[model samples]
Structures are given as C-alpha cells and as structure tokens.
Target: MAISYDNTGRGIKVLVNGVHMKTIPVLLLEAFKNHHGKIAFDKKRRITPEERKLLHSYLVYLKWIRKLRKTEKHLYQLIKDTYPVATRKVITLDSERFELVLDNNLKIKCPEKIYLLFTEKPVIIHSNY
Candidate 1:
C-alpha cells in the first residue's frame, strides 16, 4: 500500500493479491474504526478558525516527524555499514526521545527532532576496524 499524505488519492493504497483494488490507507481505516467505527472529517466550505488551526498543527507535526525519520534512518544506515553491529533501542523521556544502538565498544545515540532546542553534546570513541 502506498501511503501518501495530503493527496487526493492519499491514505493507504491497498492491493489485493498484487492488484490495485483500494486506494486508502488501511491504518486510516483502523483509526476511524477505533475512534467510532467511522471516518470523521470536518467537512465544510470554510472550517472554523480553531478547527483550521488544529488541522494545520497536525499536518505540520506529521511533516516534521516524516523528515526526522528520514534523517534518522539515513544516519543509522551509515553507521551500521561502518560499525560492526549494534543493539538498537529507543529511550523516551517527557518530550524528548533518542535511539541508542549499542555495540561492544560503542554506544550510538541519535536524538529526536526536539533535541535541536538543547545544547547537543558530542562524544568521540576509538574504534578498531
């Protein structure tokens, strides 16, 4: 399924046995079903100011997370190629989170999107390759 956010044919594109049958995200269906077993979108010519604000906030958050994940995956892949291997885990505290991939001689810590606000610290280690 192709999940394209903010597109007309957006949501999870589903294929049944390798044939495109539905073009909606399956997870979206699950979300709607979980909330009330139905899809609830505020449909109106002009949304209320507050509603628009909330919608904007959600979309912005999604974009921020998507970009952050891309950055993280790229970095992780790079490190994985150079390093022997690592046990990966996520640590979340309050509004912040980080990924820790531990090898016998090293611990790789990658911060989340919110980590940019603080003073980031860099730790160097010697690796015998």
Candidate 2:
C-alpha cells in the first residue's frame, strides 16, 4: 500500500493498490456501510480490466474531497424521523441500485467511491451518552 501526502496538501492520504471487484463480505460491508463517510482503496486486489478503470476513476476523485464518516447526530435523526414515513429498515439502496424491502422506502444512496476514500481508519466505533 502506498500513501501520498504533500507538504501543502490537505491532511489526507491517497492509497493506490490493484483493484478487485467482488461482492463485499456481507457483515463487514454492512458495518462499513452503516457509516456516513467515504473510504479509499489502497490494497492490492485482482480485478478485471473494466473494473480496474472504474476503480481508478473512484481513486482519482478521492484526492479532491475531505471525506468524512456520517455522524449519527447529523444524519440519524433525519433518517429516524423521515425514514418510517418514507423508507424503512428493509430498504436497501445503493447509488447504482435500489432494493425496496418495504413500503415508503427512500433510503439514501451513496457511491462506492466513498468507501475507497478511507481505507485506514479503524472499523470500531465507541459511544457514550
């Protein structure tokens, strides 16, 4: 994995590794998706020519934004208050596809580039209220 950061660049790192396109592991993908942020891809993975091009496009996009995880305080309330009315837990939506698991489902859809924007952050979350 290679991380590139310049003296004047924002406090972000870009990791470039081979791309591998496969169905993300369910549990890990679930937890990763739960966040309101973007992650970047930096590890080596075997991928087809088409997938490699797409993945490369996503990586280039990452160098421009300050991607952050979704803050529950910022997005959850909106989901809770607006969801039951518009969409429900059964609804699964991705930027490219929408799977309605229930009525009035209108879940937010984000692109995969978000995941590739952050590949080094810890996968665990700690909370206290």
Candidate 3:
C-alpha cells in the first residue's frame, strides 16, 4: 500500500501492487468526509482481479466530481441506513460484482481500496454548519 502526494502537488497517488491505480485529488479527500463512519470494507479474504478493477472504477467516479451524483449518493445512503436482515448482503452494479456486509458498527463494508482511500489521513471537512 503506497500513497503519496504527487510531485505536482495537486493530489495523492494510490498504488496497489506497485501499479498506479488512482491519483485522488486534494478536494476528493475532503469530499470523503461524509463517508468516514458510514462506509467501510472487510478485507477478510483475498481480493480478486476483477473486484479490484471494479473498485478502481468506482473510486474514479467518486472522485471525479466535488459532490456525489444524486443516484450514487442515494445508493450509499441506502447501504448505510438499511439493515442486512438476509444471510448474505452482497451488492453488484451491473455486470461488476462485489460484497457488502453491514457490520456491528452499522458501517457498510465493501472492498478495501475504497475503505483505505477515504480513510486516508488529513481528511478535512469544510462546512458552514
């Protein structure tokens, strides 16, 4: 796990397995503030190649804009607010597949990369209230 501020000083670069995955902007870190406790990931087992790619794309979309799209925001809120009354609480977007487990903390646990990126240090939240 290697995360470093790029020489350009615009954002941080995340490298998984020594391969460049995403260069998350400084603003993106701030945008992640809302997801701190509401979302998490369980890395109890190995992450498959396809799952890694899926998570990579997801993060790309998440950091692309300052605010999350309404649909995306609603989706995550549902994951956070709902209880997993079923045996397996897995969620898949289109053809991509992944798993989500609502832990005792009530945080939705998905893939590790998403968890780590959002939980990265210096997550400053700017708000009026």
Candidate 4:
C-alpha cells in the first residue's frame, strides 16, 4: 500500500497493491479540537507520531472496509455505519507489527506493512474497553 499527502497537505491518499483505495482530509483543526487533547494544528509542519499512527490505523480499517464491500456487501452495509465510528481503545506501533484494539475489545493485527509508505513500522496493543 502507498500513502501520500495531497498537494494542499490537508488530505491523504491510500493505495493498496498499487491501486487507490481511499482519500481523507487531515482535518487538523477538528482533530485537535475533538480527538487530540492538548495538541495543536500546524499546517507548515509535518504530522506527529500520534497522527501517523492514527492515519495508519484508519487506512487499515479502510482496507478492511473495501474488502468487506467486495466480498460481503450486505454485511459491509450493516457494519459500515458503526465500524468507522467505533472508538479505538488502544493502538501500538513499532518497527515490526501493528495492532488495534477496538471499543468492543476486539483486536486486529497486521505483521506486514499495509501501506508501503509506512514500511517496517509496527503497531501493537490490547484493550479492555
């Protein structure tokens, strides 16, 4: 997978297997006001580590969503509304793996890079929430 920031630096493009999958705005102001406590938005600066992790998790989730859409359209529709809205209970990242703990205590693991742009870095975590 490949990830790239838009020319305006306010959006991201996600590609899997060299195919574009999704694009989402950075929404720095909203993220700072809503999710990132004590963090400030800086258009002239690069994204922080936290933001990078968040983006990686989001891309993984999007990849899952696309797969579901192709294989199980009805199930995808049933869960789509809630999936993205599901709170992330925990997120861990490093150089070899990635893990996501969702609000329902379900965990997801990806040992390989889902986005080529973020190779080697791994994320892992557990959550009770």
TM-score ranking, best first: 4, 1, 3, 2
lDDT pick, better of 1 and 2: 1
Instruction: Assess every candidate by TM-score.
Output: 0.26, 0.19, 0.22, 0.38
lDDT of 4: 0.46
The reply for model 1, stretches above 4 Å from the true place, is 1-45, 74-129
Identify the leading candidate in terms of TM-score.
Answer: 4
All candidates: CA RMSD (Å)? 13.3, 15.3, 14.9, 12.5
Error (Å) of candidate 4 at residue 59 is 0.8
Ranking by lDDT: 4, 3, 1, 2
User: Which candidate should be chosen as best, given lDDT against the real structure?
Assistant: 4
Structure candidate 1, residue pairs in collision: 11-25, 12-24, 12-25
lDDT computed for candidate 3: 0.39
lDDT of 3 by residue, 9-107 (tens): 865554445655455455544333333232222332233444444445444535432143443566565553333321222334433322333344353
Number of clashing residue pairs, candidate 4? 10
Tens digit of per-residue lDDT, candidate 1, span 1-129: 332223245454333345433334433443222222122233332334443333343344345446656777764454442322323334334332344333445545544432222213532333333
Q: Write the per-residue lDDT of candidate 4 for residues 58-123, one digit (tens) a residue.
A: 556566767879988876675564323222223334333344334455444423443333333433
Q: Which has the higher lDDT value, candidate number 3 or candidate number 4? A: 4
